[model samples]
Target: MKKFLVLGVLFILPIVAYLFFASGVNNFAKLPVLTPAISDVTNFKSLSEENVSLEGKITVLSIYGDNVEGREGNAFNLNEKIYDKNYNFKDFQLVVIAQDGQQEQVKSLLNELSSTIDIKKWKFVFGSKEEIIKFYKSLDTNLKLDKHLSTSHAFIIDKNKSLRGRQENNNEEVRYGYDTSSVADLTNAMVDDVKVILAEYRLALKKYNKKEGLK
Candidate 1:
């Protein structure tokens, strides 16, 4: 009887420990929302003249400013590291905000990217300089756009139009955006965070469906 009891304890202990750690991992998988209810981009028109909205979508947002040509390297880096991996997610999008007159330059860039990539989920929206500044301000982040109205950094915006990123990184700094120029930042940090946010939504959806089924 004593031998049987010891065997049962040993078998059950491992299972319990596994379950406990698995729960912790799932809880940690959720990405934190830094800013809530960010402004939508529906007021602006895409390169195709269609209105774009941040609602109901997981967006990687960037401002390319007026020099779409100058930032060609940044665009390519983002395409390779980020969009190429997650573009197939139905609600995922890459929206670049550019000044209104840069449509031709944007078209040229798109033409080059399209030759080698699907480019369908990638969108470029145009707005007046004033409108662009106003929209950027609505994000309420600590970062600033450069003099050219561009930044090499890209941000994650969730389905609720909230800004998402690490509140404190390894350097003990608040990280609101990923540097598009750095492959390491995209590969090491942005990729994982994007997965987390997508998983967070997937779990919520699963719960919702299960509740509906129970009803």
Candidate 2:
């Protein structure tokens, strides 16, 4: 009777552990989509004159405003904390939208960053002030761009052109964007959220491939 009891305990332990981890994965499968199908950036012209698009890409979108030169610190903070860690992911990109005339300043900043990091996936796009404002408004978030047409906040835009972020829960305020200037915010919140979105896509892809395999 004691041998049978021990065998039953051993058999149940593995099942319990599997169920626990599976529940955790399911809970984090999708990051909350705060705004659905926001504007795409295909209309803007990249610094290289290449066409840039937010569709079918996981974009870290930012507005450098008219004061591109003044936001150098913010750029470096994001580069070190966020871009460097995730740039290797195939569909991941960092897109900065700056006023049309700030091309030189944006180029200079990218040149400096290129010395130590791969800037290939980091794209800077140009647009008129009115166009930039129009695009920013499309996000439909409470966050505002300053008079200089800039904000320290950077947003995550998924492949479907939707704004993804944390919802208000446990008395916490809704977070539409991460503060680029705050390393703690990027490290603790932004990085983890990025991982969740990436994992979500990977799981979807696996399911798609499996379905095709059966066919």
Candidate 3:
């Protein structure tokens, strides 16, 4: 009886330990860095007279055309999906950029959007189409205002101003999802990337601030 009990304990212990350690490793695996730091743009302003920057917050940016049908509505859908899941993170911001002269329309769209989510975290900005395209280029995206700007897409910019797309830093397949697979897939994948950034940032802070007694 004693010999049989020992064999059972040994088999159970190794299986339990392997599962525990495997789970931890999976959680700590590194996700892609996405992109280099985003470049700055000038001549754009957020709603309510606030200046905009990519510093110190995670920014999700989408470019919209005022005259394009359903542009603002498409952006609103993506915003609602992300906000509904991750609204607890105060540093997460959604920035919608429109072509110049569309401020009133953008404002109206925002007014409607405010009824559903925290519109305070949503910023509507516009500049000349030329400058807006220039701003898009600064982020290293493939968008061209003349042809390829799609309101259905959103770019995740990290707190350090880096665009989070396709910068694979690990063997793990945890890269940003840039495909238009479906609205549900797109929103959920983007939110997962956001959580990855937050997790990495917190881990970095803990490791680097240990000696400083930082929180």
Model 3, 1-215: lDDT tens digits are 99999999998999999888655544764455556776653368666778877788877777775553457556656666675666567687777777767777777777777787767777777677677766777765554453534345677788777777555346545344343324775665766666677666666676678957854
Q: Which ten residues in a row are the worst by lDDT in model 3? A: 172-181
- Candidate 1 local lDDT, 1-215, one digit each (tens): 99999999999999999888657547877777889998999988898877688999999999988878888999999998889989998899999999989999999999999998899999999888898899999888888998888889999999999999988867858888999889898899998888888777777887899999999
The C-alpha lDDT values of all candidates are 0.89, 0.91, 0.66
lDDT of 2 at 106: 90
For model 2 the local lDDT of residue 86 reads 92
TM-score of each: 0.87, 0.89, 0.73
What local lDDT score does residue 138 receive in model 3, on the 0 to 100 scale? 73
What CA root-mean-square deviation does each model show from the true structure? 3.8, 3.1, 5.3
- Cα error, residue 191 of model 3, in Å, equals 2.2
The lDDT ranking, best first, is 2, 1, 3
Candidate 2, 6-90: lDDT as tens digits? 9999999999998887667667557999999998888888999888899999999989989889888888998998899899989
Top of the candidates by lDDT: 2
